[model samples]
Target chain A: MLDTAFEALKTFDWGSDLAALAPIEEAATASHGKPEARQDLENRLIAALKGTLTRDAQDYICRKLANVGTAAAVPTLAGLLLNKGNSHMSRFALEQIPAAEADQALRDALPKVSGDLKVGVISSIGARRDSAAVPALSSLLSDSDPAVARAAILALGAIGSVESAAALQTALRAAGDRRATMIDAVLKCAESLLASNQVATASSIYKAFTDESQPRIVRLAATRGLLACASQPAVRSI
Target chain B: MSVIKKPTRRDFMKTTGAAFGVPYAITSAALGNSERPAASDRIVMGGIGIGNMGRGDQGAFLGRKDVQYVALSDVREEVRDKSKANVDRHYNNGDCKVYNDFRELLARTDIDAVHVATPDHWHAIMVIEACRNGKDVYCQKPETLTLREGPLMIAAARRYGRVVSGGSQRVLEDYRKYVAPAWAGEFGKIKSINVNVGPLPQLCNLPGETKSEAIDWDLWLGPAPWAPYNPKRCSGSFSINGASWRSFSDYSGGGMTDWGAHHFGGATFICDVRDQQPFEVNYFDDSNGKYLAYRYQNGLTIYHNKPKTDQLLIEGTPGEKLAPKPVPGYKGEGGIYGDFIECVKTREKPFRDIESAVNTAALAHLGNIAYQLKRSLKWDSVKQEFVGDAEANRMTDRARREPWQL
Candidate 1:
């Protein structure tokens, strides 16, 4: 039944009867608690992804793979990342796979894709909060493309590691037309840092925005952040 | 604790007292003499997804003296224009604005708050974005599309200090008969409660139809995967049989979340576990048939579709009596809408605050995962993951289409 569904998936396009895909859905459901079964199902799904199929069929396969795909499926998924039509869905599947290889695949796609595709990859990296992407993301903060630059800043903020926060601070000094975006990203990093209990680091980021020269709302947010940092019970000497 | 005072309408009025006296041709309402608060004092509002429930939510806010409905947005041109006209007719002006994209509506700094009645898929994105833009939110019922969205939405609200309320009037109004009794301690030391709601959403593959120019089908799909725009695919009908977006997994969790929001939300509130989530979900499929028992951290269990059990059936210690406690209800005047507006003004949590709302919605999601896997499961509420279950964790959230992330 699953094989028949895979055969039907080859021709699956928009408006096709979804009933033909039931066996695959059942296989995905039944794969739970059965690691070997999941791996077999994932392997088949990955193979189907590499096969010739309609855009819809590929999209459907990507959705299924998102649930069960592992590192083994990353290379095939990564190959689709540079294709504009398939990049979003490729990243869609990659973002949820929760594997180091998937993160590496996205980071690898960063320099390879440009425009909206680049922005999408950066976002997928942020969604995964892959700290290792901080260096690559920071380098794009001053990209000529405003959207790409803004996305990189936001992605760095989402990662919110000590290094990501430092990268944002460097970008903040010359934010140019992306000033508001930069400030929002910095505050986002501060919040994330504060949540992760890096109070001192979060406080430094917040203090930079609290000057009278900053916008009132920005100052207010910074002040709030500073107050939050102050409220954290200080660590005693061990 | 140091208190930071936000500049409010009252603060503006105190500083601009001279300008009020010099105002020319001011209407009675604008002058604050006709029982309505002055226009400056009223909360400026907008509506996103102005369809069935959106239109009703618009009417509720539009009719309020304390709310100033200034704009409406919907992907479909037909409803957007109609909603704009309704707001214009109410305010006696053409100032009402309409947008094809909700982002533009949220972009307006003047909009103090927004009511989102979009499909379940758009709720988290719109609400979080609205909060990011400094607007309070009153999102329609089933305020989440996936379990992962709940925490993100709650975090956004907290980070921005926004008053986010889940839109489910029925949770309190229709279920009050049970809630009041339970809160009043009629069911002393409640052991468990049963809630029956489901037929989870299924995958949609409706044949593509000629896309309507009036509706921006792409915008309507938003973060959902690209699909052919069939009428039934985007229909707002309540059916869960592939006839409406409610029936599709891409947009909703079928009745499991659609009506489950009301049923599960009401059950949790009645049992006083609205603030908590189940740590364990034990599934049974035997002579009694398939059902789920959700055990909360507080020892109270919520049974879902257990055979021979009526909905909202509370089982408690039979002879134990307890002291009556106060039953919480909506603040201010008009039901849930007023509660939201009042909370917006006071900076207080709304009746169905996002945390409790998310917890309530989590029940449905947990049950869905349990039923889908056809086995028992454990959930770590704090970590917000399926305990040691890789396959189940993957289902916590689906990959959103590009440019849309929490």
Candidate 2:
């Protein structure tokens, strides 16, 4: 039955009859919460990724890997990151993987991909809050393509930290008409820092906005951000 | 039980006036100096804003043979006529009165209770006015459009000493009967709660179009900033089932505040954070929608998480630790209905009263403020304002256009 299910999966059409795959699904269900049993099931999914399967079949494996994919699944998903058709679902699964290798794979994919795919990779890095991507995101802040530059700004915001805040401030010089957009991202970065209990650093970002030279909305936002920092308790857990 | 005799015209006026703290002279004048019955053995209901939820509420109230829907009101001519037809069908006659304006219905001296299901903007004023008119109110969720409205609703309910239930109905009698055990026992000392009520509201960007003639578009736009009517903006989909004035910032807070009330009202109680508030919110923009999150001083986190596959059943996934058994032919946790009827009889607060709805809705407002500002807000929940954030504080109340001003 398992053999039949795997064979059926090789050509899986989302629109096709899927009842034969019940045994495979049951096997996967039985393996849930049992990591060792789950790995065997995950291996089948991983093996399916390497076969001559339909794009739908690959997407199915990628989604399943979101819950069960591990370090071993990283290399395959990493390779898919360059395959335009598979990159999205590849990043989707990779984003959920807890391995440092997976994070490293996403960081490596950032500078190599172009257009929205590159933006997607950048976003996934920030989703993981992998602060290591800060230098990479900062370099892209001046990228000629406005969307890439905007995505970089947003990713930096998502990975909010003293370093990312400084990177954003440095990019502000290059933002020109996109200054408001940059300010929005920086405010978010400041918020993330406050949430992480780095009140002093977050307060510093807000304090700069409070300067009379800033735009009125920016000043108001900073003033409010400063008040929030002042109200924090001694500890934090976000 | 001895059947109590109904009050005469003079006694009825006195009873109604006494219930709402209105002077007898004013009460009689509002009733057009017509003879009126002060009390009735059966509940004499007049539904105001009988659009979607308003009609649903009437259906529930009608389940009791004793509920007599004497009058119906809606700004739209079609809705009022349709609702009036439903009411007439219940009585098996054309005895139900209909009106395009709610104030006309409220002025009827025979009405003992009201069901208000207006758009988000009209909720506070209608509910407050109904309370003043000495009618018990079953208002819809998101009891107020702004923080200012919540207090006014509470004041009216208290001042009038009328039974008022804000419609986060899950907290009413059936809600307590089912969810109480889960809170006290099943979900032992809940360390955290995930509301999973979906994302923050987005700005209304429904493509514009020509307005319709059947709907009173201007009346529907009551109090909201005047903008040209679009079919999407008006009676949306026309079937009361499909109408949604929610996406627009003018009328509603999208799905966040709408369903958030249902989830937040119960989550606060289950998490043992009732009457308390989460200190700050943390949001991550996921491009598709925001991953909105909040942190309470007690170390609990509440946020929206779209459920994964196989995570829901017909009665659905039990949250925190709710295990509600399916009772055949039973409407889901008929708590708000039970509370309203009981309160009307006893002249007491409904179990899920205005104050509780106000608190839960306040949380949703906070989340909206945080989302709008793209920052975490340090809320002084006691003051009901952001600590020093005027911009965030300003968002707590929208500027109502003239005539709708609070």
Candidate 3:
């Protein structure tokens, strides 16, 4: 019963039969109890990933693809990295892919994805803690949207990149009250980077946050960040 | 019946009004108003199940100058005596009465209202009888044992013109200030209502016990279908041994009907979906057998489990978290009792009024019916019956033993 359902899902062009796919999706997640049944479902999902379909269908297939968690979908998801048209689906798919494949895809996508979509993709990559995507994510700290810039700064912190610290410091200098949330993000990222032995990067982030002319809360958070980093006697000595 | 020694006036005031901040001068002023009934003119109050919950209800009425504690009754003699003493200790007028049987207490013309705090199965009969005898009722949550009995209870309340309220206090307290705004698109087309009532503890088997003199074995069983007098069933000592009599088919409809009445009642009330049954209902019992989920037509999924969470989570489109913040006063056991009394005086329907609570009870009953039949059964809320499922229909209402008809 499971094999037939999976086969039906694979061969059926979701462009024409989008409604019918829901049951198949439900059955895939439903308690099938057998490992062979799940594998059959995954194979059908992989087949669906290869097909051309509407955005909704692609989104649905992408979700199933992620759920299947196969190495095969990595290439398909990676192909969408440079393709901004379905970047959300691509980012979602990339996030679910194993770190080795996802990191490269996210790094490639970061330069190409502009605006809100770029921020989303960078955040997704950062959330996965793929250090390879750090350079791309760090570049976003200077993006147009304060939200996106904040997200990028936080992503850099998560990745703990020394190269990203200088960018965060520059972003912090220009950021006034208009980007308090973003500034907090940069301070946090710098703290994480410092903990990873990237002290020069952390010190620059700390200085930016502690600038007295900045918002009182931001300065306090920055001071707190310095204290946290300084708590390590070896780092304090420096 | 043994006459219990009563506390003095000072002790009585200390016991009852210690937490009530109203000074005697203000109380006297409030009582002096011509509109307010005198203590002697106030309605006499009696409690049937004066256990933990029952005593709490009794205490609320005890504070009201418009009510006098007249009688106390419980099958458990200890609860009855203790409750009677508690009432006397507060009133200190030596005018209170006590009875082991609730019927004798209800028959007294002095008592104007009865708070039915017995287990779920006993609610219908007690409430209906109370109404028939011209007594207003405040029955605890999940107001009926089964779906069929809810409408009958509603009919009894309406037919008798007696004010009846379900013990779900969230129904009162600025719920409209929270729910109405959400329903009016303030929350931007509610995507889903996730009601998590936490998880129930593991069921335990009953242990061997020596029957104590405090309990009445036969009377405690009451209208429930005949079973041997097990001390574990009555004393709740078997709770740790996984022998939850209430969780079983014969005793109670598990936690779904028990807690679902309170949690699901809040969800449906907030959604303003009203008495219409869901277009589709899917129930899922948790893998651990400790929880049950019921998804309704409005995309609201109610989870009835043990450790009740944020009573109801009303979710919507991005950036809109517009469900009413749960009011502090609308929580725990006493919350409902206080709300019911205020509504009774104001002549306003409470948050868990009979009409809405009946709908909640109906939903819980349908979930149980679906589980018991081991197949999904479509419900007609208007007609209040299973669509074409005759076997499922039989479970709607149980037969009352001789002379207990509604």
Candidate 4:
């Protein structure tokens, strides 16, 4: 039944009868208990992905791989990361793999892809909170494309490490047209920082924006962030 | 319920006093009036995904004198045009701005609040983005499409200090009969309640049809996997069959979440367990068929599709009476919508706050996972994951297509 599904998958496209793929779906669930069965299914799906198949076929396999794929499936998925038609779905599979290999694949692809594709990779990295990729993302802050630059800023914000917060603070000083975007990202970083109990670090980020030189709204957000920091148990302890 | 302070004519005058110097120039719409409050004092509102429910929500807010509905958004041209026409008709002007993208509507700093009635998939992204943009949200039921979204949405709302309310009017209104009795302690020491909902969402492999010019197909499928534009695939119908996006696992949790948002929402409210999630889900597959018993830490159990049990049927200690606890009701005039708007003004939690709504939605999701895995599972509510079950943990959230991350 699984072989029959794979055979039909070669021509599978949007609107195809989904009944032909029932075996693959069934295997995804039935293999949950049997690790060997799960790995075998993953291997078969990865092979089909590497074969000459329709985009729909690849999409289905990637989704299944996301559920059962291990580090073994990372390399093949990463190979498609630069393919415009396949990058998003590849990232889709990579994002949920819960393996360090998936994170490394995304970071490696960051310098290889540009524009929207790069932005997509950056987003996946941020979603994974790949602290190792923070340096690579920080370098993209000044990328020529505003979308790429903004994606980097947002990705850094999502990472929300003390280093990411510092990068955002540095970017805020000369963010030009991206200043508002940077401030929002910086505040997001501060909020996450506060959440992780780095109240003093969050307070420092907040204090930077509270100056009279900043916009009233930015000052208001900064003041609120500072107030939140002050109200923290760590700060209250002192 | 606490006494709600209605904006008196004098109060309106005091609030809109900034235009006192320009009284001669102030029109009826801009000036303080007995029937309609001044425009300056009203909650500036917008609607996203103005479909069937969106239209109803729009009308609810539009009918309110305290709300000034300024904008509308929908992926389909006809829906957007018709909704804008409705808004224009209500205000007697063609000034209601329309957009194809909801982000455009959320970007307007002047817009104080937004009502999101998009499909189940779009709810979390729109709500969180709206909150991030400093706009309060009144998002439709099943506000979360995944377990992970619940916490993120709640956090975004809290961090921004935005008044975010879940759209589940039926939880309190439709289930009032059961709710009142349960809260009144008519059934002493409530044991368990059965909520019958589902036919979990299935994969969508609908044959693609010719793309319609009337709708932005790409925008409509935003963040979801690429699929051919089939009418039934994106239909706004309530049915959870292949006829609508509600039937697809990518977009919804079928009836489990579609109507589960109301049924489970009602069941939890009746059991006074709206704020809690089951600590363990025991799946049963016997001669009778499959069902689930969700055990909560509070000693309350919720049975999902248990055999021969009626929906929202409370199994409790019989004949023994206890002191009645006050049933929480909507704060202001017009049901849940009024509750949301009133909370927006007073900064109070709404009758169906996001946390409680997420909890209800979480029940449907947890049950769906149990059914999908066909195994009993222990859930660590604080961690929001299955205990020691990596396979079950993988089912907690799905990978969204790129450029859209929570």
Best by TM-score: 1
Error of 1 at A41 (Å): 1.9
Off by over 4 Å in 4: A206-237, B1-25
Candidate 2 clashing pairs? B12-B38
Clashing pairs in model 1, backbone N/Cα/C closer than 3 A = A15-B207
Q: Which 10 consecutive residues of model 1 chain B have the lowest summed lDDT?
A: B10-19
Q: Give the per-residue lDDT digits (tens) of candidate 2, residues B1-406.
A: 9999766434664666789988644333234322432224457788878767777888888765445678888878878788888888875778789887787988787788998888788888788768656678988887877776786677557544667888865543323543555444555444555665635544333444665556666667765644455665655322222245665556776666787777777666655565676777776676556655667887766664523312111121345444443321112225568668767776666656788778888878877766655566787765666776544554565423322322
Query: What order do you get sorting by DockQ, best first?
Result: 1, 4, 2, 3
Question: What DockQ, on C-alphas, does every prediction get?
Answer: 0.55, 0.01, 0.01, 0.48
Docking quality of model 1: it rates as: medium
- Candidates sorted on lDDT, descending: 1, 4, 2, 3
Off by over 4 Å in 3: A1-238, B1-37, B170-184, B197-209, B236-245, B274-276, B283-313, B318-335
Whole-model lDDT for model 3 versus the true structure? 0.60
If scored against the real structure, what TM-score would every candidate get?
0.93, 0.52, 0.51, 0.92
Q: How much lDDT does each candidate structure score?
A: 0.87, 0.70, 0.60, 0.86
- Model 3 Cα displacement at B253 (Å)? 2.2
Give me candidate 3's TM-score against the actual structure: 0.51
Ranking by TM-score: 1, 4, 2, 3
Better of 1 and 2 by TM-score: 1
lDDT of 4 at A228: 92
